[model samples]
Target: MPFILTRITRDGLSRLMAKYVVGQIVCHERGWMDTHMKQIKKDCIGWHTFHSFRSLDQLTVGVMGLGKIGLTTAKVLKGFGCRVHGLVRTPRSHSSVEPFVDQLWHGREGLADFLKDCDYLVNLMPSTPLTHGLLGDEVLTGASRRPVIVNVGRGDIITEADLLKALEQGWIFAAVLDCYEKEPIPEDSFLWTHPRVVMTPHNSYNNNEDYKRHHIQTEFIVNFENFLAGQPLTGEVDWQTGY
Candidate 1:
């Protein structure tokens, strides 16, 4: 038997994650969570004095990692009239992402400068040695604007301890996390009770078994047909890149 893998849901997952990121930003900026809690606890209503609230178009969003998902996220944000910036480890030739971003920062040397200009920092990078702890003190401290950190990527990019310190030190405003250093986060984890944090199980991608099975079968059939026709397949993973 031969093993086959397909990323038939990559685009859908990216769009879903983008929506989550935008929703978190709106919730944080508009104080929706706090207001909801107060309404439930104190029976308060009509308390809508939000000093820090701002529209999405007024914010500058920085996206780390400009792969397929990152590019999709950027495109969605751009559609909302946001000033989007993208970061990559190296430069690409004639990249499709260029038209979606207002600025592009290349290499680690520019990370600090990039962080300084962002009102929201979205992380969509993969798990690799170079990306481990990449969002710790050194990089986060450069966020002079105190951007809200949104991590829909691998959790190991920033240590939980460092994330708390960054929040306490005022390096970043808050965090919206879908992934964590540990899954199902420990019962005693500070993140569970942190007021400035929002946690979600690693479900940015839809996990409906029926929907997934349908897509997988469709992708496989399409690829099999293409193979028979001596045509290229979609989502051919490169082992060396580990995508």
Candidate 2:
């Protein structure tokens, strides 16, 4: 699996970034901790309504790419009693995640339906020619529940302009993006101070402890040894599919 940057949308010039790995180092559920605290801080010592905070049990989470990492995220959401739906290229009876997802959708045809009633939509889709600019005004505006958009996937999959438009029009509740169509996202970008958006510097795939754990290095060495022995590698990349 690899992460790639195809073309710069706003800047018209060509710039690229690449990564080769099957797993992500980011476990942003930790960042959700800070988000919750920030929300509380914003509320201040104001009078509290009994229903000010919605319980996790009342929410439904939709994951856009139900691969290995997505499945792991679904498990966490399930633990919160959320009804989790996953969007996959194909819904398989034998998929390890089938048991975790309450519903499944396939391809672009299934995207609108998947966003229909979700309280939160998590994007984990890989970048490819087919997926570039996939989540734009039409898709966000179609979301019936006005769900919060959380993007930890490739940035080019969604456009910042469309996202801003969607937010301004109340097409979506808010957005939390760990990556962007252009990164080291331009300092002048309004997203830096946008009330409806939370931006992080493309660090979703980084963790200080990851290296200490030998998580990636160990896996690479083992796979290399397997290759030397003519055994199966941990992952395979199909240039056409781009996964």
Candidate 3:
């Protein structure tokens, strides 16, 4: 059988994930959900108790792995008047993300500096040798801002034990996790009950099955045409880089 390499177009998915990140930042970092829940339960209606909440415009956000999803997230945050920062494996000239990012960091050498002052750190990196367990004690400890962790990336990017320690030790504020080191997260996991955690079962990319199938078929048709025309195919994987 002949194989035709293809992938679901990320434009729509990237936009959706970007919006999800913003929603997570607003609800988790600013304590909106907690406040709302309290009001619904008739626990408290006073505004003073929630005065600590900050506006999105006042935040400084850092995005790791400035790929399609990361770039989209940064752009959406910038639209809310945030000072956006981005981390990439290497530098690029005239990149699409340049306009949105106030500051950019290149490679692991600059990771510490990139994370230091961020009010929110969004992770969108893939699972790779360079990224596995990249956000452990050393990296988390360097964040002076005690940033809220927003991870929609591969879960292994963070060490679960170290993340728990960071929260316990106050190295970070809270977390909005859509992915985890383990699927189904085990019945005995602390993350399920952690006061500062808001988690989802990796549902960020979910959509109607029919809708997804339509897009996948469209992508395949486009790639097939490109192949016949001897044109560069979209979503071509770089085996060496493992993206």
Q: Find the candidate with the highest lDDT and give its number.
A: 3
lDDT (Cα, 0-100) at 176 in candidate 2? 77
Candidate 3: worst-modelled 10 consecutive residues by lDDT: 1-10
Q: Over the stretch 12-131, how does candidate 2's per-residue lDDT look in tens digits?
A: 010011120111112222244345555778854432323334566687888888766677677666776778988876656536676778888888888888888987887888888878
- Identify the runs in model 2 with alpha carbons over 4 angstroms from their true place: 1-51, 94-96, 210-213
Pairs in steric clash, model 1: none
Point out where model 3 deviates above 4 Å: 1-5, 39-41, 44-51, 94-96, 224-231
**Model 1 residue 34 distance off true place after TM-score fit, in angstroms:** 0.9
**In what order do the candidates fall by lDDT, top score first?**
3, 1, 2
Global lDDT of each candidate: 0.83, 0.68, 0.84
**Each candidate's TM vs. the true structure?**
0.87, 0.77, 0.89
What's the candidate order when arranged by decreasing TM-score? 3, 1, 2
Candidate 3, 215: how far from true, in Å?
2.6
Select the stronger candidate by TM-score from 1 and 2: 1
Model 1 lDDT tens row, 1-243:
334544554466678778888888888888888888877777455455454788999999999998888888898888888999888876764355767888888767778778888999999998877788888756788888999999998999899999999999899889999999988799999999998999888787665787667666777788989978988889875555555
- Tens-place lDDT digits, model 3, residues 46-103: 6347457788899999999888888888889998999998888767653656788998
Clashes (candidate 3) = 0
Candidate 1 to truth, TM:
0.87
Clash number for candidate 2: 0
In angstroms, give how far residue 134 of model 1 lies from its true place. Answer: 1.2
The candidate with the higher lDDT, 2 or 3, is: 3
